[model samples]
Target: MKLTLRLGKRLNRSWQVDAMLMLLLGVFGAFMAIPLIYVINNAFKPLDELFIFPPKLFVRNPTFENFGDLLQVMKGSWVPFSRYIFNTFFITAAGTAGHILLASAAAYPLAKHKFRGHKVLFTIIVLSLMFSPHVTAIPNYMIMSSIGWIDSYKALIIPAFAFPLGLYLMKQFMEQIPDALLEAAKIDGASEYRIFWQIVMPLVKPAWLTLLILMMQMLWGADGGSFIYSEQLKTMHFAMGQIIQGGIARAGAGAAVAVVVMIVPIVTFLLSQSSVIQTMASSGMKD
Candidate 1:
């Protein structure tokens, strides 16, 4: 199939094609955004509006009743809402920070240094991505139990450091850094650690920011991954689940919880998505 081209001094695709593509993309984007828009609208909806027969996509009677009701319900719980908030924040902060440092450190050697079994090791990491986390869930649970990490923060934070996709993206992005930079640092008597911390880390800002967004999204929505059995160790996601499961009377409050759950990740993505895209543009080759 041939696309029509027009000459405006230099030849280019016709405006008709560009407009068609944009129209299609606009329609697709609207379709994908419907659920998020519904969630936001439902959060402010009163109980009567929520129970309307032949329910509407948009809220007609918007109010903060849902949030107020949500607060009331949370207050009735055995554990305070603030404790769950702290648990979620701590896990997300620790997990994201650790994953960034460890994945970057691991990627630097794989991208810049030549050593035995390097290709085999990276190939294994790439292949690991093809498998789902559920595949190893049983073994992971057994190991956590045996190691006494169950019902603890370590069970949540430590495993995140070895995230396969994080290492993969970091390594691919690091390959764009020229070897001469590291060589020059070495010639000046810089240790490998010094070269990595001072020389390499500074140049990979975009990559780490990109990884930060990815890891933040993952760890932010985490529900302890079934590893923590204690109520105090549960994250915000677990609290959201409990709220939403409270049957029809609590539906308004549930919507409020859902809205609150969605806000942080969306704000985080809005902040870091540009840097993620910039780094991804150059993350095409591996050394």
Candidate 2:
């Protein structure tokens, strides 16, 4: 497919095929956005509107009663709602930050330096991404159980720091950083640590931001699964699950709870969306 490029410093006429592709993309975007809009609309919809025949796409009569009901439900919980909120935020923040730092650190050497086993090491990491997390759940549980990390934040945070996808993406992005830049820093007497911390990391801001968005979304919605037996250690996602399992009377509140659960990741994405786009656009390119 041929795409029309804009002329330098000026608007240019679009090719007919390019215009058709743009129109198709616009339609696809709208199709993709429907679920998000529906979720937002549901949070404001009354129960009558929710169960109406044919099921309206948008809210007919919006109200805050659902949020009000959600607050009441949360207030009735044996554990304070604030505790659940704290656990969720604490886990998300720690996991996302640690994953970015560790993934980036591990990626740098694999990317810029060719060690004896670098190819095999990177290939292993890439292959690890092929298996779903569920495939290793039993092993993870056994290890966590053996190490006594079960029911603790460490079970969630520590494992996240070694996420292969982050390392793979970070390594790929870092490979795009020219070797001459690192050599220049070395010639200026920059220590390896200084080169990595001050020079390399700043240059890969877009890649790390993309990782932040990815990790934040994954870790934020974590329900602690089998690893967390303690209620106090549970995340907002767990609480949301509980609310959603409520019968029809709780429908409105469930929508509100869904909104609460989704907002953080959406906000994080919005903040770094441009950087993510840039990283994704050029990630396949190399020096």
Predicted structure with the largest TM-score when compared to the true one = 2
lDDT of 1 by residue, 1-287 (tens): 35545666654567788898899999999999999998999898898988888877898878998899989988997999898999999999999999999999999999988899999999999999998988988888899899999999999899898889999988988888888878898899999999999988888888898888888888888998589888988998998898899999999999899889988989988998888788867667544
Global lDDT of each candidate:
0.88, 0.91
In the range 150-227, model 2's lDDT, one tens digit per residue, is: 999999999999999999988998899889989998999999999999988998999999999999999988999789
RMSD of each: 3.0, 2.6
TM-score of each model, paired residue for residue:
0.90, 0.94
User: How many residue pairs clash per model?
Assistant: 0, 0
Q: What lDDT is obtained when candidate 1 is compared to the true structure?
A: 0.88
